[model samples]
Target: MFPIRDHNPSGRTPFVTYALIAINMLVFLGYWGQFSAPGLDQFFYTWGLVPEQILSGRGGLTLITHMFLHGGWMHLLGNMLFLWIFGDNMEDAFGHLRYLGFYILCGLAAAALQIAGDPTSNGPMVGASGAIAGVLGGYLLLFPRAKVDVLLIFIVFFRIFAIQAWIVLGIWFGLQLMNGLGATQDGVAYLAHVGGFVAGAVLTFPALMRRGGVQFWRQTHGQPPHPQAKYRLAPSHIPRVPRK
Candidate 1:
């Protein structure tokens, strides 16, 4: 199950989040026609993170640039969705410019870890998953108890239930760390997730401490400054047998 929405809405417009989403979409579309395996490989090799290129003191900016690139439509969509969902509040907390810096730096840290994890591998790493993972990290630290709307689908068996952000993101992070350990060379770079997450948490310290340290959670009590969303179920056509 994954989250479809959230209860906490941002007090101000998430301009950076929207812009990032649009930019990612446009970039992905710009290269959609070049999705052939060979072309895609070349594209990533040129723009994606190359430990050799980085270690050689060249193409260092790719760690940040690659955050804007994506592997496919689904990859772009998934990253943008998560960024949109949690970015606003964090951006609000850190302000637009600072939030942007945090995001990029976390992505940079993510690439660094991946490179250190496998410096010789020629695989080209792309996508904002690592950076968005950073956002998840910030959200977890800032709003551990906040309510997040998660859709629990059970293949036409179970129902959907809105759970807390802690649960949703926490489970995701746990999986990332676990998978990072269990499968490092599987090409997913779960280590990036772990790295980005740690970076978000560490970097967000100033803001969190400024807001009265641990008391910030006590003050906000793990809720966004918006009204909670109500969930509605789809209409079913099952017939009732008069309680038989």
Candidate 2:
């Protein structure tokens, strides 16, 4: 299942979220032209987080730079979509400047964990998934009851269902943990996802406590700080055939 959107709306404009999306897109477009050239791999190696390089104390800045680089179009789009949906509310909670700092910190934590997991791997890891997982964690803590629209595809059948944030994010983290334990490859950095999520939740705990801890949950009821949004799926318009 993939999240389409969320029912929770931010009280103020999420300019930082928008700016991040723009920058990521612009960076991707700038790098797309070099994909066909010989410099693409070199670019990734130089900018992307190579675990071995990081472990060797080389390319120290790659932990941050890797977030803006994506392996493919779908990778970029998927990461941006999650960020777009969940990031605004996070920025709303933390304010713009803090949210930006939080994002980079989470990404750094993610890279550090992934590097620790495979300190000798030479493959360069890239994408914003790790950082976005952090946003998911913060969202879960702040709005566990918020409704997120998830699209589920079952073979030929497809459906869009609204699920609570806790369930969705909990399941996501569980999967990441399971995969991180079961897999032993350089394909996906499941450890990064796990680390980023934990970092986001832990870092946001102080804020949650200042908001009255359990009292905040009682007041907001796990919804947005303002009001809960209502959603209705558009009616299916496929014409029915006349039966005999």
Candidate 3:
């Protein structure tokens, strides 16, 4: 299942979130399909976070640069979609600058954990999944009861369900931990995701306390502090067909 949107819209325009999406898109386009397989691997080695390179006291910049790189189209799209769905409310709560800082910090924490988990591995890690996992972490802490519409695909069947934020995020966090434990050269940085998520929640705790902690949840009923958005599906105009 994937979250498509949230009921709680930001009170103001989320400039930082929009800028992040645009930047990721533009950066992907800069290198998309422009290199051969060998060249692409070389590029990732240079820009992506490699545990060995980092431990060797080199390629320091990859920690930050890797967050902007993606392995493929699906990788980029999935991360961007999560960011778009959950990022606005975070930006609204933390404001632009703090939110950006939180994002980067989460990414750093993710990289650190991944490196610590397998320092000997030479594989390059790419994509914003780790950082986006941080956003999910913060979102869960602040708005556990907020309604999120998730799209569930079951083979040929598909459906949308409006689930509470806590349930969705809780399950996601659990999956990361479960997968991280059994992980063996799977090429997915489940540990990084776990680290990013925990860091996001921890960093967001201060803001939560300032808002009155449990009292804050009481005040807003564990939802966005501002008014929640209501949506209605438009009726389709396609003519119905009758079968004999």
lDDT of 1 by residue, 1-244 (tens): 6676676777778888888988988888888998875777878888898888888788777877788998778778788889988999899889889888999888988888878877876777888999889898998888887777666577786545567888899899999999987865666879888899989988888878987877877777866545765546532234668965
**lDDT at position 11, candidate 3:** 84
lDDT of 2 by residue, 1-244 (tens): 7988998889879998999899899999998987899989989999999999987879988888999889889989999999999999999999999999999888988988888888888989999888888898888999999988888788987877788899989999999999998875658899999989999999889889989999999998887787666667732244679999
Instruction: Give one digit per residue, the lDDT tens place, for model 3 in 36-150.
Output: 5468888988999999999999999999999999978899999999999999988988999999999999999999999999999898999888998999999999999999888
- TM-score, one value per model: 0.89, 0.91, 0.92
Q: Pairing residues by index, what is the TM-score of model 3?
A: 0.92
lDDT of each: 0.82, 0.89, 0.90
Top TM-score model: 3
The ten-residue window of minimal lDDT in model 1 covers 229-238
Please give the range of 10 consecutive residues that has the lowest summed lDDT in model 3: 231-240
Poorest 10 consecutive residues of model 2 by lDDT?
Answer: 229-238
Report the number of backbone clashes for model 2: 0
For model 3 the local lDDT of residue 118 reads: 93
